[model samples]
Target: MDKEQQIAPSAGQKGEEQHAIDVGTGEHGDGGGGIAGDAAEASENERLALVEEPGKKKSTRVAALDAFRGLTIVLMILVDDAGGAYERMDHSPWNGCTLADFVMPFFLFIVGIAIAFALKRVPKLGATMKKITIRTLKMLFWGLLLQGGYSHAPDDLSYGVDMKKIRWCGILQRIALVYFVVALIEAFTTKVRPTTVRSGPYAIFHAYRWQWLGGFIAFVIYMVTTFSLYVPDWSYVYHIDGDVNDGKQFTIQCGVRGHLDPACNAVGHVDRMVWGINHLYMQPVWIRSKDCTFSSPRTGPLRTDAPSWCLGPFEPEGLLSSISSILSGTIGIHYGHVLIHFKTHKERLKHWLLMGFSLLVLGILLHFTNAIPINKQLYSFSYVCFTAGAAGVVLSAFYILIDVWGFRTPFLFLEWIGMNAMLVFVLAAQAIFPAFVNGWYYDSPGNTLVSWIQKHVFINVWHSQRLGTLLYVIFGEIVFWGVVSGILHKLGIYWKL
Candidate 1:
């Protein structure tokens, strides 16, 4: 992928297709009774993203959807770049929830919701499958190129990775896999028309009940394999560039079943067996935990008494976790169905609140009882419930504020960021934007504009390393990208697979 990637190819198609869509007239006022459309009318290539052009009365995009998506993108950028500075905002080392842990589920949830709108209209099976396949392949390719241990980016300036070391799964890769699965289910289920007598208040559920069943099946598979699969002792070699002791072998003692710790877990074991150790993410989030690092929650040298598995690699977006995460997308799909069936704001919010509350309560029950601790690394059932519930509540709130009351001014930047999510994600969160900036340095590679601004502007002004890094990420990174994304949105430039 380029520093700046492809614009949505369906822009013209979106314009052409808007003629057929009956856009809700409540663009600025209290949302009126919506149409229970047969399905969404979005073009297949840009199915996951539906953006309404400014002042385009017939545009199919919902302001709340864009704003919700934008918010996740901003949080994604914030959490990713702000790691190791503050413990609260950082991803939990293990078995806990933090601000950063919400991004993955939120994105997946948003995708689920988008899938509903994208396939809102009855789609031609051949064309829809073609788009889905192309998009999935593109997402996988980009995921591999951006991550996959190939791109050290501006930090190392290397562009080569040993085939043995290329990671097979990551954030986008997981999204691609889940999107493929969920989109297919939603596509087929679009034929199941809702009926007043059969569904009543549960029409949305009735239409997409297959998705829920699939989710339950996935949950059962995850639970059984997580508890029953035996994990044997695993070993890894460690090396630090410039350190005297670079090559050291470490063996982790497992030889047991149903492990949830970072070292000996079924999730990690399945990933190791399938993808191979070198194909797994080398530096896991757990390395910063108190068990491994000398400075807990901060990336640094290892503790003197670190566990043997501390040196081992773990893939957070491994197969089991990815399967568990499918539930998140399925929940989003349910919300999408609500949008389709419920035309009035009152009905929509009512269903959303009840469902969100139920999920939240069940998640809390599971967590407090130790049935399943909230673990993002494992993508535990409790994590899925809690985060997906939170996502629903937050989205409903956005619908009220942006869709109902028309509070779009304050969140305009977020809207822009959300509208061009794939673009902003690539440019900001993926280090491509920083690398592009770093490409223009004053003499030494370290003397880039980004380094100067962070140090002299944010860091120097704050007068503390921790505070400075935080400020730079918020202002230097987030704010700057917001403006850039806003500009791109204005230019009618957006990204798609």
Candidate 2:
């Protein structure tokens, strides 16, 4: 695997080829109409109308898409670097909903949508399967690495690092896993046509079919696992719960570890083992499994919180649920891709409004199904469906107004950030800053700038700590993007993942 794989590919040949098919018309929009030929012509016309300079238009790229991506990234940075300010932030109690809760799922959903565009490109260019494979693996490895890797802590912060107790999985790991699975399906579905001027053995491949099939299979599997598999196991438990603890804590957090795995419950039993006993660390929800809430390291005789048992790979967006996430992304990609091919303004607007409302309905419906649960933490299936639908609506609006209607002036800043999302996110959130730099650049000078404004510039700047922190982070994000816009203007690295 290599670094290249760590990043998802850009919307490649598919966008280009689709455009090529609809070329000629200076104003064709991909508003999901009937003919590819006519749509291409209209798209050409629309493309020409957007910019006076031929080179600058392509260089500037899709303003709407960039704006959406940028907005998502900004929110991500705000949520992640919340900076010890919880009060001002909106958070649901345990199994509840809050405004901030939507950010993660939205991010993952976007990643899936991006994959759709990338996969579309893989086939047309005849990109090698080997390259894709290598890239996917590399990303997976880095994702895991981001989770904590061999070290307990993820780089350094004010909080001390603990190597022995590092979490085994996290956001990057999830991204890697999802990307690998999606890429694999895409590769299997697409095939290389035998080229007379090239290779001898290759014929043709449906590299994309597998992704479609796999997506269906994954959904079915999630249903089976959540409904049939876990339900039965839970049902088998004696009615003792009916008379025992009345606490909502009836919801167990460990599976297979309490009674099923004696060693996990008795931590002392494995003291001599080399990697320590991972039984307590293997939570069912964290990985692909037919169980849930099965590990409790504290009850395992350790009688200590230090080497606390793993939280059971318990993810809001575990393997079983990611199916919905992928679906959401696929919808966005397809909708965006198809819309860009429309020729007539009226037709484009009609499709955009219709699809937008349809998706909004689907999202609202999915939100009610507590079965899949609307949880951003697990990237729950229902969450994906709902969020994706909403994202589509948003994308459609952007497509119609900015791309089709040429009303793109208001979102230029967001588009700038969107063009370089990954870099912006990593640089803003994960990149470490020394204490001195934080004091000099952020606290001291930042306060001066803030004071120059109308609002209070100190700790009391906002009514709540969390609000102040959020505002501060947002300010940081804007500054980062400003620097990024300048660099991009100079170096032309607009979309380097």
The best candidate by TM-score is: 1
lDDT of each: 0.75, 0.43
- Candidate 2 global TM-score: 0.61
What lDDT tens digits, residue by residue, belong to model 1 across residues 164-213?
78888999999988888887786677666453214477656766678888
List candidate 1 stretches off by more than 4 Å.
1-61, 195-201
lDDT of 1: 0.75
Which of the numbered candidates is closest to the native, going by highest lDDT? 1
State the lDDT of candidate 2 residue by residue for 220-277, as single tens digits. Answer: 6655444443211111111224533222222232333222121122111222132332
Alpha-carbon shift of residue 347 in model 1 (angstroms): 1.0
Candidate 2 regions with alpha-carbon error over 4 angstroms = 1-60, 83-91, 94-97, 119-127, 149-164, 191-211, 231-313, 340-356, 369-372, 431-457, 460-464, 494-497
What is the alpha-carbon RMSD of candidate 2 to the true structure? 12.6
